[model samples]
Target: MEVAAKPAIRGAASIVRALEAHGVRYVFSIPGVHTLSLYRALDDSAVIQTVLPRHEQGAGYMADGYARVSEGVGVAVTITGPGVTNILTPIAQAFADSSRVFLIATNLERPFLNRLEGNLHELTDQLAVVRPVVKWAYRAMTADELAPAIAEGFRQLWTGRPRPVYLEVPLDLLDEATALAVEPATPPPPSEPAPHLIEHAAQLLRNAKRVLVFAGGGAVSRRVAPLLKEFVEAIGAVVLTSLMGKGALPEDHPQVAGAFGYRWSPDNPVVTLMERSDLTIVIGSGLGVRTTANGTMPLPTPLIHIDIDEHEFGKRYQPDVALAADAAVTLSALLAAVHAGARPREGWTPEEIAPVKHALRTPPDERTARYVPYLEAVRAALPREAIIVNDMTMLCYEGVRFLPVYEPRSYLFPRGFGTLGSSLPTAIGAKLARPDVPVVSLNGDGGFQFTLEELGVLAHYRFPVIVVIFNDSTHTAVKVAMHRAYPGHYRDVDLVNPDYVKLAAAYGLTAVRVASPSELEVTLRHAVEANEPMVIDVPIALERYA
Candidate 1:
């Protein structure tokens, strides 16, 4: 008697199962011929939620934004060649910001690999192009290797210096069947803090009088805020946060100095404090070009760098002492050591720090009667907990400066990538992710035009996201920057905008256009109360803010 053959599993099926086992809830993608196998597998499985985006790039950005809010790995699936290339921008942004994301690309058949051959959707050295921008890039050669490759990708993504990972699955391999019994891989154990390194870091802090703490994106973990607050208060050290680390500490806290880089105001006090400090304790932040202004000058102080990734230390800037440990663990250990060597302190008072805080708190005085009314209207209409997503325009800078964020992640913007069309989709994702919280997307006229189709997605899903379009009728940010660069010359930067209110209504969403700023408050309240997807198109003078 012949034994029945075991059920053959496709490589794509194995990948889907691996992703599900790794706890990935959502997978965003734009379907193509190369991804048909995976699409079929996904359709057959009930483990993962799949979303189809109109554009591949939009899908990638949605994943990136979702990861930012969810604080977990986000996955985006795409076909080979153009599909994979289109997502590079979002993937690069993820890599730059150390965001956890997985990009699964379905490649052409193995016979057509890496040659100038005429195979459909074939690309020469695709993985090479993506390697520099990802934490790890893997190409599975066989069905048996698929599970282990995916497991490795997850390990690399979650390990030290977490970032986006890429896995390219060839069509031939995806179509092939296997009989191997794939056992689920065990996840690695969490890393522990080095006791000796913690003691050394503590000793440096205890001896220093003018101590400062620079917190980075990696320091934004859930427990980091309280741990940092405790450590800083114990050491009497002034605390500063990077742009990504904003709201890590309460802005009103006495020990909090201010945000270090990416300040709305040029003369930010945290920059001044960094320049004067004697000892700087950097926690979980890589002093990258943007964070440290391209490393033009060090902090003019002895630095103690603490992070999970050892390779990050002394990469761009030198450190006096480096502790390769998780931020929470290292902070906990350091706090204990510092408390043991407690000393009395004498330093600047709250009165001296008041001016710095006041300067940052001052609103932009674009006080045209119209502008004043508009600002007041928005402030009065929106709830304090409303999540505000801004576009990469002068309105965004104005919003960041004037609009208050009462909580962390409440203010979402593409600061690292500075992508224009991100606000609407990001707001949609944020609203869907947290239905109870009200979401407001502030987009410029130019930015809104890029992804206006997303309004249909909002309407279809019935997501109640409030969109406020700043109708300036131009790429005002570019025009202003060009004017400053040339001193007088104006180029092709102005634009003619459509009636956005009508555009919103066309997508089956509630829409209203506000011309006089006096109508802003009533219009906003009506939109909010409607409790449906709505747009409040506000016509504003760009010159006032820019």
Candidate 2:
């Protein structure tokens, strides 16, 4: 109300007011001299909560986590230059994963911008650095332009393909006074699914036997999941989720097979399922390298592809029917179209689906055996509703397939980018976004070291997160690959040590070292009961585990 009521306010105040109008609840921020004006406005604001993170990267990751779990836009703020550069990884990660992260950074004044000046925190082109990773990157020249820039950022964030949006306010603008407030974005709704596209997909499925539905992260939205479930069940199709699509269908559902389809090995059950199927419908996934296991996995012909972005239609494999529209809308139309033809199809039977679900739970090799129990222990210890945020680690690698997730948005991972050191701050953001729910994070000692400093932020803010670290003193993934490729020459794979129990204790957390899975489970239960931030160290050798 104050936004429009006031005749004019400073640029920083206008930015704050605009964010409030657009319903930004929390801002993951690290205050710096160039962005202090905005922080001052934040201090005086009553509605929005500002979170302080140790690093700009951590802040960006927190925003990413917040956005994914909350199913809304997550905002992060930083000072100029290094702030923008430091946040690049998170932006790239969000870009890869299609998270709605809004990044606001300050830039050098107009005269110095795009000019090679040695001013503090100055970059020749701040927008250029993040442009590739963000859906849109903007730099506002005047205080009056701040509101419109924010509106456009939200518009880009909500309208089409979801990705990170960047807006840089100049150092001069933050101090310039303008009585401008951000207006709520009024983007046009996504177009309805095309009749011809829906009819073609339905006709193909009607003629085919043994249909399969390959789902991805884009299929995991609230608006899309129920429609997806109805459509899959209506067609009697077996559901296989890509890593990002893990929980779109409940893993325990009779027809729902988890991420077992990610691997393309001949013996892989889902790959076999794909090979056997006459037709496949892919929804809300780009079918990227990670999802397709670097293109080792194959999709059969007569495929129906549905996505919000038309660019993804023929990026990898051309679909027989490509409906580039909102997933929910497309599924709804497809369901009606399929029902109209009403053909009895012989999709994968219960007998066939059983083995696939079995294959996911049963460890195929000794390497899988090492981490499957850990995920099982975690699953048994936490409720199905508890949220899990994962890092790039050996244990979490197993979690993509072995871990049973029951709902959409309940599990979070940088699955697309596989970025290291994101779980800690990501968990913090998820916890902050959904305070009533339990939040758990699994990290490797290697990746955890990247953003472990964010533990201080968690302790300081009293955000209770069950942080489980699989400490093997090496980057197990890289080491194993190196050892396999080069025999005895695994350089830089081994890591120097730290006493995690002692280290975590210093950060005001209840730190413990668990000796066994049983011990880890018991300690985890206690940590959950205690309802405080904690770190549990499980020391093992990569030689034995990986």
lDDT of 1 at 480: 77
Residue-by-residue lDDT tens digits, candidate 2, 268-325: 7666778778887899888765566655567877888988888887767778998888
The best candidate by lDDT is 2
Q: What is the TM-score of each candidate against the true structure?
A: 0.88, 0.96
Model 1 C-alpha lDDT per residue in residues 411-469, reported as the tens digit of each score: 67677777778788777766655667777888888988887777877777787888988
Q: Determine which window of 10 residues in candidate 1 has minimal summed lDDT.
A: 363-372
Backbone clashes under 3 angstroms, per model:
0, 2
Error of 2 at 7 (Å): 1.5
Reference-based TM-score, model 2: 0.96
Cα deviation at 458, candidate 2, in Å, is 1.4
